[model samples]
Target: MTLKSPISIYDAQGLAFGILMASLGVTFLKAAALVTGQTAGAAVLLSYLLPLDFGVFFVLISLPFFWLSWVRRSASFTLRTITAVVGISVVSPLLGAFIRFETLPPFLAAILAGACSGVGLIALFRHGASAGGLGILALIVEERTGFRTGWFQMCFDAVIFALALLVLPLDGVLYSCIGAMVLNAIIGWNFRVAQAMPAQQVG
Candidate 1:
């Protein structure tokens, strides 16, 4: 494929995949009463604290980080992250309105949401893009420290979940932490698998 055409196609697919992942991530957060880290976690915390739409809050919180990504990372990475961010910002509320689970248990919700979010995250990373929250921060940390970003991300998520406990009930906080753990574990496994895969296979 020509450079222009291939890049265009990749962007389109990445956008779709990013939206799906982010939406599922949000769903998991809502269901399990969990938070990730950085912007998205901030958004979730703010939404719980204040009366605000999660999607709007998420985009507003991510703007500064988007600017930071542009300065710190490649233009392509910035562009891809921006696309994913916008897509998630737009789709999350719509998904929220359409999908309702009145009876699902919290643990099951956590497991399913974590799995879906993980799959979505793997798709975004494979496409040279991201879901643009803790994921971006993790990527940056991994590039700088050579320590596994997944573990770093988990630490941040744990802190956020801990703070969340102060705001929410103890049980809710516990479940949320569990959900975060599952999500981060999936992220760690996916990253290692990606690293293990041959360059030719990944390409």
Candidate 2:
């Protein structure tokens, strides 16, 4: 597919907003010492297995998926996805650098961060873009199967969480898994509401 730059103000705003939310989600995962699904999840998994920066790892893992979206979807979709991913890649580490909440409880941090991330993700999806990686896959699956996107994401997160147990302590894996579930729940709830609001208004 041919690629082109996004020109509209609405597209730019959507890309910016989506990226901001995704960055917050990544930051929350770091703060809670939790793992997620998609490229970010793979980044966390890689960080445990290798000596690499998670943010760099995130971008690297997302590249293939970005290309896939470019090929399968519109250039506009790819551009927005790339913008969001790059934004998250840059913002995640910066947030990690500037804000380290060591004293906060992991559960609380995970919930707050996951909720913020979910909202950001939904905003991105609603705007016709994605945060990359399994996010694209999740969207495709939801569209095809008519299953809830949140559940699709949760399944992916579970796989990653299981892999995490192989590398991390049992308790850490458990907390990460729980954190992922909470994040998925937040996304699912919001998605359902967004879906329903239109129908209700139409009625």
* Model 1 stretches with alpha carbons more than 4 Å out: 1-6, 31-34, 192-203
C-alpha root-mean-square deviation, candidate 2: 4.5
Question: Model 2, which residues run further than 4 Å from truth?
Answer: 1-5, 192-203
Q: Candidate 2 versus the native: TM-score?
A: 0.85
Q: Each prediction's TM-score against the native?
A: 0.84, 0.85
Clashing pairs in 2: none
lDDT of each: 0.68, 0.73
Residue range with the least summed lDDT across 10 consecutive positions in model 2: 194-203
Residue lDDT tens for model 2, 1-203? 54544456876786688788777777777776777775688897787678887878888888888777766666766777777888888887888788777486767766766777787888777766778898877766665566777888897787787778887778767767766777788778777423522221111
Winner by TM-score? 2
Candidate 2 lDDT at 133 equals: 90
